[model samples]
Target: MTKLISQYTALLDKLDRLDWLVPTLARLSFLAVLFFYFWNSATLKIDGSIFSPSAGAFGQIFPKAAEAVLYDVTQLNIFQRLVIFGGTVAEFVLPVLIVIGLMTRVAALAMIGFVMVQTLVDVTGHGVALGSLFDSAQGLIDQRVMWILLFAILVFKGAGPVSLDALLRKRAT
Candidate 1:
């Protein structure tokens, strides 16, 4: 039992020596973005109007123009709701997988798909004219671009050195 404990301790020490900051940061950022997206999705009232009613009411007193981004009322279906729930859950779960370095590619791919669908919805449903080089659609474009880049990095890099995936791969070989 003592020997087994010692071996496990030694293994942990070796793992601690591995540089995990970069991957961990990436995973953490991913989680943060997911949280933001989920919060916005759950809170934002979609009323099929250019200006959100809630925002308009708030704007009257605040004197600041609310970012009343519009979405398609028709697209808000049961399946889409399920997708949003799934994506939110995935956002919460995938980061843990990424931090541990288990099935990193799969988690990254899932996130990528989630972001892509969101981007598509934003483009098609919202009045964001496609391929417009103007600053009018800058915010939407920037958000989508960032997600694309982040997912691409995760896909290409997998989890960093300190992940469980690395250990498993080492064991398999």
Candidate 2:
């Protein structure tokens, strides 16, 4: 029994040495799953130019308000416009920062907040069902929670060794 325990400990210790792969794989997973998801959404928000948001942007971001204004984006208040613009920009920018491993923790943290807001918008604005945790596999809450967990991994572990953050840290030192 003691020899078996020793062998198990040695095997676990070997696996522990690959800790760097955790963050790297987390970033890769973000790139693969979420990067383009956000990119495409951002594209839909823009109309003629990147600076100009489409009618769909207002409808998506502020559903009731957009309906109130009849989807005329120009009718939205400055603050509302700013929010839509900022959200659109973040959707495009945050994922790139995470994938490139630049300002990773901050980016991931922001992504967590973004996911929370997105979930709220889906629930409140779009009427998506907010299912209870562990209740079922399908719902805005469960899906967004998983996305937030992925971002949390980056928040805690950072971009790992193969990242620009790591390179800059090495250079600065």
Candidate 3:
């Protein structure tokens, strides 16, 4: 136990010294791949639509309300379609902002929101179940929790001394 604890402590110490750009780039790369995967799925129309079945039924039940939300004319199921559309937009926009380190906090926050909602939908609507904390799709989706935590760290750390964000901050001062 003592040996394991020491090993973990040593690892954490190494992490502490890593340049922020390394982690930032890693995070950006991860998000970029995720974006591509989701975008490709959306483009292929792999599913019936992006909208939830419940949402589509709701639209059918309340056409007026659906129309008010601009979901009336949708043929591919409003909820599913909207989800795909929203995801596509986020995939395109957020990664760019994150890669450039512009408004990174805001982008990370938005990403957290997106991942949360999608996870909820997948769990509740699709009947996806998680077997364990580390092996579940839920855990994978909530991996943003880690990213958000990292982003919070970055916000405090100011994107390190070499980032565009840091450069801008330096210039401002």
lDDT leader: 2
User: Ten consecutive residues with minimal summed lDDT in candidate 3?
Assistant: 52-61
Error of 1 at 77 (Å): 6.6
Q: Which candidate comes out best when scored by TM-score?
A: 2
Identify the runs in model 2 with alpha carbons over 4 angstroms from their true place.
none
Candidate 2 vs 3: which has more lDDT = 2
lDDT of 3 at 106: 76
lDDT of 2: 0.90
Write candidate 1's Cα lDDT for 24-133 as tens digits: 56766766765456445533432343222233222221222222323333334455444444544565566567656689888778777766766665565544655763
Which pairs of residues clash in candidate 3, taking residues 3 or more apart in a chain or in different chains?
50-80, 50-81, 51-79, 51-80, 51-81, 52-80
Off by over 4 Å in 1: 1-25, 28-85, 133-138
lDDT per residue for candidate 2 within 49-150, as digits (tens), equals 877889999999999999998999889888887898899999989999999999999999999999888888988999877756668556547767889889
Q: Candidate 3: TM-score?
A: 0.54
Candidate 3 lDDT, tens digit per residue, 1-173? 99999999999999878766664665565456555654554444323544333334334334445556765344445564565556656756775666677766677667667667666655555545644446765576456556556555545544445457767887999
Ranking by lDDT: 2, 1, 3
TM-score-based ranking: 2, 3, 1
